[model samples]
Target: MGGFELTLDTLRDLAEGAAVLGTGGGGDPYVGRLLVEQQLRAGRAVRIIGVDELPDDALVLPCALMGAPTVFHEKLPGAAGIVTALRTLEDRLGRRAAATMPIECGGFNSMIPLVLGAETGLPVVDADGMGRAFPELQMETFAVMGVPGSPMSIASDHGDAGIIDAVDNRRMEMLARAVTVQMGGSAYICDYPMDAREVRRTAVPGTLTLAARIGATLRQARDDHRDPFAALTAMLADTIYSHGVVLFRGKVADIERRTVAGFARGRVRLTAMDDPGDQMEIVFQNEHLVARRNGQPAAIVPDLICTLNSETGAPVTTEALTYGQRLTVYAISTPRIMRSPEALACFGPAGFGLDDPYVPVEQLVGGP
Candidate 1:
């Protein structure tokens, strides 16, 4: 992404790619994509940099949208929610942001920072706290490296702002989630506050650039009538599960939901496309937790479970699941950063209230 001049086309490509990497979580990037497009249209300047370019003492934080994916469908967040959080965080930290970074690789969070950076003239860092998406604040590369998750600043659309300082990331997830739910199911979080030194050591390098590249690749492939699934597979180590249906064709057969101590937890079941005799189940705790065929687990926690529109192969979020429609269920292994004990400890099945064995997804999938 060298010395690139910002443009709407570029942001659109980035958003599309982020959607692919979102792996069925991070909410839809459509609104965020449009939001960034508007900023680019307004002639904003945005710079993207590799984390390697960061100063040793810099305070780099990863921030993103957080809330019930359900509410996201009903009340589209006022697009400025992210910038609001950045401003609120700066006010409390008593410092200007040196660089802005994405908390995860999903479309919305990854692209939102570009617009914020454009407006603030802060360079968007190339790396992210997570190379892929995870359900909770505690389940990031920063956590794997032992950087604390709190002293995080959260901002809401109602002009409400506060600092989240917790005993740990789990506590932070719980506390921030409580406040965010009260604030209307979602808010922005600036967390994993780290100096440039830690950022260099822990963060996934070139994730932002990688996101743009992925977006571009997908777009190019589609235009050329190439297989997007093949391109996606080459881009990351993930599995693709699909039929031929588009986004609007899927049906939600069953949903089992529960709120355990503030975290939204549940599973959704869908009957097969052509045969009701077959079935699929998607488990989630804030994000897609697991997927299964018949009674055997097909995809599990720590493994990416992205539901793609069958025709397009784009990622799908839990919030988007519906009844009886055909859909592609992808299962990608967790990024290396998320495979660590600490990362898994926070988001593994146990964290989501399951007693299943904690096994690396690769181990479960065998090879290729």
Candidate 2:
């Protein structure tokens, strides 16, 4: 298949699938779905091209919304913000962006670039830096592969915009976070400019298609009166992820959420509905980092820890968690690229202030 024009129906599927990949972070896909739906209704075309099909010299820009996901719930951005950021970056680099791609394939970031592409008349490359969502900008495959994250542009819905030329990816994230907070907790950014060759090497291939396929699989399972979770696991195991399973099934008992240092920091406690004494806890700094059951680590970062509504099989975002909600937690292995020593150092449990050693989700779950 070459590429296809994005429609409202496909966007809804992408949003649902992205929320599952988001690992309880990357902002709300519902908001993203609404934004992209608006663009489609306005007669704009958003096309998704496979990354391998991009010209070797094509200029690709990765764009996303940055900051606390909670903030986005209250403050919606004007489409102009993403346009401004992309245009600002293009002007700064003295070259036009040939295509746009998502910085991450999970949550709102997966769909945000589609909106930009539709608005800017640029096709979106069907790939992303993180096959899943990550809290920090530096924790992407692009950064892990030595791609510079500088010469970036950030813009707010209020017509404020700024450019950053950082020495490194970490500095880029630090600087951007400050600006994001000042912009009322969220902003749009275009960063990690690269040629098609670099994109092919650093990005997770076909993630946009993967997200869509996942959504379609789940929808079909639900419609056929089959077990959606079983179908989801089968689909994930057939992909680069290679492993997927429900780690816990319970009802939320307590939740502690706070905006700390410009990030949504929180923990969720769940009690097993079948066994009240059995409990599971998930910790997060935007994206889920660790999950423990009865104080024993069940899953750790670099691997995906996702929450789904038990009854509906719908993905749930961290900021949307509420007490007494029935949910099932799934643990899927990270892409092989993300499990490398270098990549782990950047986004593992230690990176999130957890002293736990990195463990594969399959190992923790006693094989898939």
Candidate 3:
């Protein structure tokens, strides 16, 4: 498919879909939708182009918001933060960025680049570093494929800006996390500078389009009085995320949340309203990592653990969960590229301090 122009209607759909893919991380997409909507109203037309359409020599910069999602609820990013970071990165690189891509294709990070593209007059590539949102900077296909995360630029709504040149992606994440904490716990970043060829090879293709489609499908399902959960599973089954299953349907029983080391660290307990004896637990560090049913492992990180409001079919972020809220939890498979042993080592349950081994969501769910 050719490039598509983004409109307010589609932006709403993209935001909803992206939140589903966020897996309880990446902050809320509503904030991002509002930012992009403002740009659209100001007459900026952002184009989403397929990776295949990009010229091989084009320079593409992956962009995102970093730090604790909880911070974003209190301190909204400046409208110019992403654009400033993009310009700063281009200046540091000594060349203009031909386009901007999302560092991840879930939640606010997914839409930030579109707003940046509208403001900077750059096309937004319809691809991203992660097929879904990940909690850390290094949990990306670009970093896994040997792309450097720096020289990176970060800008805060507080008018602070800084450049970081780390020896590697891990160091980049560490240094950037320090800077974000100093920036009041949230900042925008432009990193993973790559040519079109590298982007095509390293990025998860068509995730932007997938987000939009997922949003549209959910809307249609609701309008037609069909099961939104069923619609979601069918849609995901057709994509690289070939399996999606509801792990549990219940009400929140308890929560233990705290911000530690610049990340939202916590776990939530759920008990089935219909079967009170059936219980599940989910652990998270910015994103949901491991899910267990009746204390047995049901899903692990590197796979998605998505929570949705049982009634409205809307995604529920980690910070948004509360006791007594009825919810449905779903688990989806990560992309094949992200499930490799090397990639698993970087984002698996063990990476988050859990002792369980990595397992694909499909295996746990017994197929799509």
Candidate 4:
């Protein structure tokens, strides 16, 4: 084991890093960050285990909060939420949760386990289920690899708990979302329990580490007066990935949203500052799924669609996006894990009502 501790410094770094990579989906870092920091102050240890070191027999679980990405502002679940989920799930499985993995690479997902780790005794893995947030829970790597979403468990702030078992991963996500709404718009969940064998095949390897790197680079670049986006572009280029320019920089001009299909389906309009006549609309189901430039298809699923602040350029979560908020639309290639034929089937064009061709972000960006 390289290390068996989650330090304050590391937690701060992770929080900042996660926020930058949230890709306009995961909840903000400040809320989850403060929660986890408080727990650490109380003296807790979160561990990290290399994916290869996980025992084939050991059971791995991904921990996270589930619900409308919007609920955080009205009724904060408070810091105790994550520990409640972790402990409850540990008991349900009747086995000690060997280690913890983030469900996604974004702010809240990475921070949830850290907060719980201080209250409970589980260590956070240097990994996550999804490299980035997907609108649906089933969009995680676990689902892409056919890992069952249950037997899973969730806990709400009201002390209500539920054990979920579904026939398929998508059904499980739908069931869980409905239950979360009833629990006041959010529920803490511990799911995707699988043996190390399955974990090795499905989970994005070293995603937490990757997030940390991206996070650190952004900060360092900013200090050097180097463009953060340009630095990100270079990093992706080094990896043979492609990225697009500032699509439109302005404030949200309008929003049309509804709670349907057990998910938040909405459209947010961004008024352009550079091009006064141009406007962009972002359509999402939990994560940003599509982008429209002046009512025409700009990018759709299978390609990574994300939005960020005009100046900060950090992620702008679906929940946080609203009218009068300055922003910039962006695109990047999907993680290789998500580009597979099987992956495209679930989260690609058809999944999001995208009628146009699902071009790779690289191709759309005019390639490397």
Q: After superposition, how far is residue 297 of candidate 4 from its true place, in Å?
A: 3.1
- Tens-place lDDT digits, model 3, residues 124-160: 9999988888888988889888888899999988667
Question: Could you list the CA RMSD of all candidates, in the order they appear?
Answer: 4.0, 1.0, 1.1, 2.6
Lowest lDDT sum, 10 consecutive residues, model 4, at: 238-247
How many backbone overlaps does candidate 2 show? 0
lDDT of each: 0.70, 0.90, 0.89, 0.72
TM-score of each: 0.87, 0.98, 0.98, 0.90
Q: Candidate 1, residues 1-368: lDDT per residue as tens digits?
A: 35455577777777766775676667778888777777777878788877667778887767788875556666676546677788777777787778888888774677667767876788888778767666678877778788987788888887888898799888998898889888887787788877878888888777666666667766777888887666766666431211111111234688776555434577888776667767777777656776766776766776666677666665566666665545766666655666666766766777677767666555555544
lDDT of the structure predicted as candidate 1: 0.70
* Better-scoring candidate (lDDT), 2 or 4: 2
**Given candidate 3, what's the lDDT at residue 299?**
92
Sort order, lDDT high to low: 2, 3, 4, 1
In model 4, the clashing pairs are: 46-123, 47-123
Worst 10 residues of 1 by lDDT: 239-248
Q: Report the error of model 2 at residue 118, Å.
A: 0.9
Best by lDDT: 2
Range of the 10 consecutive residues with the lowest summed lDDT in candidate 3: 359-368
